[model samples]
Target: MPRGYGGTKGVRRPGVALALHFAFADLWHDRKLSVLGVILLAALLAPPVVLHTLQVGLVETWARDLAADLRNREVVIVGEHQVDADLLAALRAWPETGFAVPEPSFFVTTQTARLVGGRGSSVPLDMRTTSPGDPVLARADLPPPGQAGLILSARAAAELKADPGSEISILLQRTPTGGAVERREVILPVAGILPEAHWPGRTGFVSEGALLGFGDYLTFSSDTPDYRAPEDDERWQSLRIYAPEVSQAPALRDRLQNAGFETRLMTDQVDRILRLETGLRQLFGLVLSLSALAFVATTILIQWLSVLRKRRDFALMAVLGMSRRETATFPLVQGATMTAIAAALALGLAAAMGGSVEAMAQGYLAQPTEIVRPNLIPLLAGALGAVALGGLAGAVAVVRLGRLDVSRALRGD
Candidate 1:
């Protein structure tokens, strides 16, 4: 009915395009109010964003550090229990198994050994059996296949004054039933040194064959003129098992316990970290829900009041042939635009807050780690959620607009 409401030839302008145009014009006309609304929305949204970023960042940092340690995934088979090849093979075949190596009986695991060309002091060290894929030796070079080399822990190396390319003389002693105590001195080359963080205390890691040989000599006095390697069917007294992931440690431990193996694992530590993450997320969720509800309520009240004040203007539009749907789109578009701008401002504020936290944390930490890592997916989802809340608020205003009596409002009634 109005000249400009429909284009020439009675072709109506696209409703959304026209609504958007009016929305922008109205927002610009009340630019100061719009800007104030944006500031309020951003203030409400920023705290949740910063809190979430911190939670995710700190939890992720802890998780990564725990994962990097590798020991958290390690499952130690306690005491001397016979582990046959069949059982070891079954464990190796398990999906959770990342690495598995057999350890000799406890008696032979520790022995007095001294570096040949250095301090010359014999240090009693626990010798662990290591294979090619051992997680403990991930950073260290593996010993030559068989029994020619050893990797010493930082403490052991420090006490022995040992270094790579040096030699160590280990004394292997055993007494047979009713036989004299036999002692044999064997020399092994130092292949590498393990970091203190990995092995800790006085410890040495040797090949499975070398450990087995030491066991044979100690158990059966097998170091005669002719020495033969042990058979493939030899049963090991213990095993060093590791899971590929921290999450898998619990399942693997449970599986081992179910199979009648007495084992010790860092599952408790992993579980504690996992529980902390869950608790933080739940806490954040509660805070975010409350904050979001307040934001929505405030937004809806603002939009509703704005519509009420502009009832005459909307009534005039209706008289000029603008449909209710087109009028509704005006508020929807305005709400979405304001929300998007507010979300952007909130994200920027969150980032600034996170950076401040990270800088402070870095000053105190020996090893600097990221305490404010922002992930893309969650950030995008948060922005979308803000926009959706805005749309919901606009919908409420639209409901109020739908009930407006156009003729009475236009007549100043």
Candidate 2:
């Protein structure tokens, strides 16, 4: 027989399988502590997991919805004076610019046939001219460029009791040279109705030529000292400038401002909303990180207590001729096993909590909330964090076991 050390030679130092077997045996022996550890980990991990899931869903949905309306976010530029054709051309040529349309006449108060047709009520409207491919109009409903008609907003149509193919009369208040106010009435047909989704206000869209012709009528029809001929009016009232995307609005606004135009962007409201969300997420993340760090500390304390309680067993193993490496490795195995079990339980608990959060979000939002399923990033972070804490505890236990005096521990002193 070939004996290597103390007449027992066939076996070398204890390997990983032996360590793992002892680890599982220890877990079964101290099942109560194992269960308590897993419960603590689950409690600590669940809330942050739920919050992370909800935040991911909300931010993604907000960004996607905003992107869908990007085409409609036209930068409106009102000059210090009225905008002119040259400015409109320059804007259309601006970098990242899509379309630039002149809105010379706006907010012309008018009466509809339904209003004068025994309805006895008038509706003030926002009127603007649109051309083909105007971002404001639905592609299928856009009137041809020279069409002489108006497209009413859904609200306007409802109030006026009008529909497509119906006629409406607009009353223009004109002041003549003698300071006499005359009401100029014009009859026009409704081309289409603007969808409620696209209606920012009680607005209407008429073809550019049709609107210019109406302006001409207002200009020369009455001998008014204040009358400005539409053709001679080089200055534009304002411009509706479309950009390729909403993200480009800030740059486009700056460019226009530098070029001597006053501009307003639709993205200002969106940016404000996004900034609020970012701030909330940042605060939440800070709280979560601190909580996680505290949990790690608590885990280290629990591991230290467990190792202290097992000192007698470690000393007995050392006395039985187990090497210092084998004795130290036992607690390491126990830590890894316990941490793995706890991480699994915690993840399951987090998933259940996430479902509840999603249901609550859907009910409160009262709209489609696009929550991502099987979100792995946060879950992985939690698992990695727990394992790292366990690894640190294992290292500490190993070092403590290495320094233990086996004789003193085994002497019951």
Candidate 3:
């Protein structure tokens, strides 16, 4: 037995004991190989994992409700003032018939004083106080009309520091049935705030009838005040659309185009997101392919060399009356044991680094507020699989040891 060794000759066979000693010593003596395996594995796997997780989360959490809104988001062109029954039916019967409702067109925006009541003061804060790129939220989340309700985006609620039952006064840009942009304020109790989305802009909402005379608020209008040039001629600049699915996008666009209705894809819609997701997946595949090549090369070369270096030691085991199986087990055991330790270290490092990556991506990629969780299935499977595979591959070198001419080898040594 060697000095300071935990076990002695009487406790275990010399070959197995020696194999165990070498196994634990691999990391301490071969530190570079340990680090290389972990680095290559993490690089190969992280990006796609993070992206897939976030996308899955958004679809499940936020998009479940938003799907209906986007499906019905489309533009309707009517030269005359009224929406006919046939036109309404035609829009609904479109191939991707997600949303068939007609949005009333026309509205007005004006600089009006709003009494955002926590203190109930009528001192108006002009549009300047609104968050940049502020859009009016749909206050329609209430339990249908005739219910007292007001709506605010999560950002607006924070800006106004408002809560349920708080009163808010909103003034539209104009009244319905055509005319000059006018001012009319309506007071309604704040029913709830919209769910927090990653978009930083602010939003506010009032009930469908909260602002009397604004029929366009419930629908769309050709005369929406393009806040950019309020005094300019109300040109045919903006439109709304209700596309059902991606397959219908081209046909629907064509339908509107043939009728001289100018249409555009609202990438704010998920189709744009789907394209972005495709790009990310391709990038992930590229990264993994590169890293995997490096990992395979490094692992095979280093391990194959390690086995060759231990040939002399293995010959000594064969000289000691060890069977062929015992001889082969020497390096297989050592490689498997080393892999176990490396996997543990890699997993810990990945867990720590994954959170930082999610935080960086949240705002950059418009990801959900939560971090993408690591895929435990692949991680575990890979960890176990790699160790088993390396152990098996290393056996080729060990098997050669059993055929060594022990007496001559020992004498030569």
Candidate 4:
């Protein structure tokens, strides 16, 4: 043995070694209670751990959906006055601009003929008419300019009971200025039906030439006997400006607005969704904080009661020349050991359950999703936090231990 190692004087110094020995002895003496403390701590920590993991999954899914929506949308600017072809050309020349197409969508009413055992129905339609160079139709595989046909959204097709190569009659209503409303019918061939995956709305597309034949070029048509040649409505009311990427949407929207048009960008919708996610996370965090406080209070009460019950034993230690400071170290060791073991078990449980919860969440979402586990960092933080809270209880016990009288304690006072 080394020179001073074998003596009680060497091993029982009033420092770490002596403190740890006393703490360990107390724990071994009441090992069942220590184990119970561990189990209780694990239960207390589980809620926040599980909630945090689920929050990650929710945020991830929302982000993916928002990004996809933004990527698929183009920044649109609607002007109070008509947007001229000159303005369209200027916008198309702008940096990061891909397509600057006039949006000639107007509200139209139509009635469908029942086909394939489907019932006839009257439906309101937002009809979009565009020129040759528009990029939107290119993504849908619509044939170039000369081919005249109507493209219907899945919902529109279902309501109309219409399909490609089927002919349908559209009732066009043109309310002339200071005259009775004029109604006309045009039979247009259905070109194709857009899959629901591509568009999630009831809409249809038509050629600008087809709409012009209905005298749709004028905002208001004339039916008076003394007829004036209708001025061409060559003015586009809105421009669908496509950006090179979704990231450029906000800046492009600003640029369009500065140049005198009201703009709506997909980024605005994405920002709102992000703000909502932040609020939800904050709410969950607040709940977790409350849960943590309850856990700490429970630990404090348990430790404080244990300390009071062991007063006689601590007094006996004091009678044997052990200092009050040495006696106080018992709770620190107990709290740390119990909380560490509990945190480890809780983390493992949370991780195991997190994967299953994420899979279920993904199944519910429109897109695939996976949650990010809080992992070792949060587990370590929880363990340390619990130890710190227990240490406060330990400090209270220490004060009581310091004030203890050996004689009174032995007499069961």
Number of the top-ranking candidate, with TM-score as the measure? 1
Candidate 2 stretches greater than 4 Å from native? 1-22, 28-32, 39-48, 59-81, 89-100, 107-124, 138-146, 159-192, 221-234, 241-269, 280-305, 317-333, 337-374, 381-385, 388-396
Residues 1-413, model 4: lDDT tens digits: 57874678545366555677878887787889888887887788777776766666656465655555534347765544476767777788988686665654343212222233336766666666655665556666765333356777788788888888776666656666788876655566777777775565666676655554544423454332121221353665565577765556666777888887787874465555566667768977887898788778777776677778888987787777777777778776766676667777777887788668777767756666444445577667776877777677677667767777888998998
Model 1 error, position 134 (Å) = 1.9
Using lDDT as the yardstick, the better of models 3 and 4 is: 4
Q: How well does candidate 1 match the true structure in TM-score terms?
A: 0.77
lDDT of 3 by residue, 92-173 (tens): 5676544433323333222233446455434322221111112213323333213345455566666666776677665554
Ranked by lDDT, the better of candidates 1 and 4 is 1
**Distance from true location, Cα of 150 in model 1, Å:** 0.9
Order the candidate numbers by TM-score, best to worst.
Answer: 1, 2, 3, 4
Model 3, position 202: C-alpha lDDT score: 53
Model 2 lDDT, residue 78, Cα: 60
lDDT for model 2 comes to 0.66
> TM-score for every candidate vs. truth?
0.77, 0.70, 0.57, 0.56
Best by lDDT: 1
User: 79-127 in candidate 2: lDDT tens per residue?
Assistant: 4346776766777887868767676555332323343453646777677
> By lDDT, highest first, what's the ranking?
1, 2, 4, 3
lDDT of 4 at 391: 75
Candidate 2 vs candidate 4, lDDT winner: 2
